[model samples]
Each structure stands twice: as structure tokens, then as C-alpha cells.
Target: MSRDRQRLLDYLVHILEAIARIERYVDDLDEVGFLTDELTQDAVIRNLEIIGEASNNIDKYYPEFSAQHDHVPFASAYEMRNALAHGYFRVDLEVVWKTLEKDLPELGLSVDKLIRQLMDENSGL
Candidate 1:
């Protein structure tokens, strides 16, 4: 595999790992208010940022990869990451919670699929 592709793959792996960690914390939440916990909030936002960065890098090498995956919200996800990373003081926890609940799992699945596709393609080559 090309170095670029390898780097993308590494980023994707990091994203997946971060997502798993965030999910572990989130899964323990019994009520909506649980999102108010500072640790949980921090972890979720950080993982989302990682996911976005990885997705963005992957898209850079394979623009069609984002469109092809269909499971991940590549552009919007990255935008959210930028907002969280750059505008943390102004970011709304409610929005972050909603995003975690609604979008994260889908994004994780999409990234996994993309990673597999890259692996398969590399093997074939």
C-alpha cells in the first residue's frame, strides 16, 4: 500500500479505537442528563474530532470514498469536529450529546467498511 493509504488506514484505526472508548462511556449513561458529566463530555467530543480528522484524511486520498461509504457523514462530521476543536467554549453539550446518540455509530460503521475496502483492494493489488 502507498504511504498515504497506510496513513489513512492508521488514522481510521485510531478513530475506531477512540469511538470504542467513547461508546463504552456513553453506554453506561442511563438518562439524558448523564451527558452533563464533564469527563463523558470531553471524551465524546475528543473521539468525534478524531473520527472527523481520520475521515477527512481518508477522503483526501479517496474523495469518492466518502460518497461511496454512504454510512459516514464525512463533510458534516468534519465540520462538527472543527467546531468542537476550535469552538469548545461556545459548543453546546446538547448538540454534542445528540450527535453522539444519533450519528456516531453510523459513522463508525462507515469507517469500518471503508477500512475493509482499502484492505481488500490492497490485497488484490
Candidate 2:
């Protein structure tokens, strides 16, 4: 992998780790509702933004990757991240909760697949 791809992968790992942490704290409606506080929500949203930014960078470096993975929802992920980063004041906790419960897991799995692909390619596997 190129240096840029490595960096992006690092960021992707960070995003995954952050998501795992948030997931540990939230397993049901009560936990999710309780974590609606600004600090906790902001941390989760920020990690998502980091994930989106890393994915965007990967797309720029490897357009073929983007082409092969068009269904990954990269643009929507970035847009949601942008909203969280720039419009935190207006961010809806329910939306964040829904995304964490739905989108993040799928995104994490996709990212892991991409990372594995990159590694296998680099290793000539």
C-alpha cells in the first residue's frame, strides 16, 4: 500500500475503535437515550467524521476502489460527518442514534473488507 493508503487505513482503524467503544456503552434504548448528552454524542460524531474523511482520502487516491465499492455510501457518510462537525448545535440525537445503530456497523464491515483487500494486494496474495 502507498503511504497515503496506510494513513487512511490508520484513520479507519481509529474510526472502528471509536465505534466499538460507543457500542460498548450502548446496547439498548435506555443506554442510547442516556448517551444523548452532548459530550458523549459529540465524541461518537467526531469519530464518524474522521472515518468519512479517511474514506474520502482513500477514494481520491484509489478511484478504482471507489468504483468497485460504489455501494459503500461514502458521500452520504461524509455528508453526515460534515453535518456533525459543522452543525453540532443543530444535530439531532435521534439521527445519530439511528446511524450508530444502523450505519456504523455496516460501514465498519465494509472498511475492514477494504483494508484486507489492500493488505492482500500489497502482499501479492
Candidate 3:
């Protein structure tokens, strides 16, 4: 594989790892527990930041790939990262909880699929 493809694969792997970490961090926590546990909240938010950073890198370095895979919310993830990184006080835990509950699983699936597709394409090449 070319260096660019390898880098992109690294980013995808980082995203998947972050997602898994977030899942494990919140595995047993309800909304209330998540909100109340500052450590877990911090861990989750940090992983989210990682996801957004990886997404941003993918968009920057692999614009064509990002454009083609419009199903992945690369822009949105980066935007959310900006919000969390810049304005921690304004973060609404309720929304975070909702995102965790609803959006993350789907995001994980999409990213996993992308990783597999990328690997398969590389193998063919």
C-alpha cells in the first residue's frame, strides 16, 4: 500500500479504537451515571475528540475518499469535536447521552465497513 493509504488506514483504525473505548467506558453506565461520573465523562469526551480528529485528518488528507463516502459523517464529527474542545461548559450531557445511545453504534458500523472495504480494495490492487 502507498503511504497515503496506510495513513488513512491508521486513521480509520484510530476511529474504531476510540469507538470501542467509548463503548467500554460507558458499558454499564446509565444516563444518570454517565452524567454524574466526571471521570467517565471525561474519558468519553476525550475519545470523541479522537474520533473527530481522525475524521478531520481523513477529510483533509483524503478528500476524495471522504467525498465518496458521504454516508460517513466526517464533517459532523469534526464539528462536534470543535464544540467539545472549545466550549466544554456549554456541552449538554443530555445531547451527549442521546448521541451515545443513538448515533455511535451506527457510526461504528459505518467506519468498520469502510475499513473492510478499504482493506479489500488494497488487496485487489
Model 3 agreement with the true structure over 21-123: per-residue lDDT tens digits: 9999999999999999999988988999999999999999999999999999998999989988998699888888898999899999999999999899999
- The candidate with the higher TM-score, 2 or 3, is 3
lDDT per residue (tens digit) for residues 1-125 in model 1: 99977987897788788889888988878446555688778877888888788767766776875567655677787888899999958988887877777877877787788779889999995
- Which wins on TM-score, candidate 1 or candidate 3? 3
Per-residue lDDT value at 32 in model 2? 50
Q: Which stretches of candidate 3 lie over 4 Å from their true place?
A: none
| Top TM-score prediction, candidate number | 3
Q: Cα-based RMSD of the predictions, in order?
A: 2.2, 2.4, 1.1
Worst 10 residues of 2 by lDDT: 27-36
- Candidate 1: C-alpha lDDT: 0.78
Q: After superposition, how far is residue 79 of candidate 3 from its true place, in Å?
A: 0.4
- lDDT of all predictions, in order shown? 0.78, 0.73, 0.93
Residue 72 in model 2: lDDT: 81
Position 69, candidate 1: lDDT: 69
Clashing pairs in 2: none
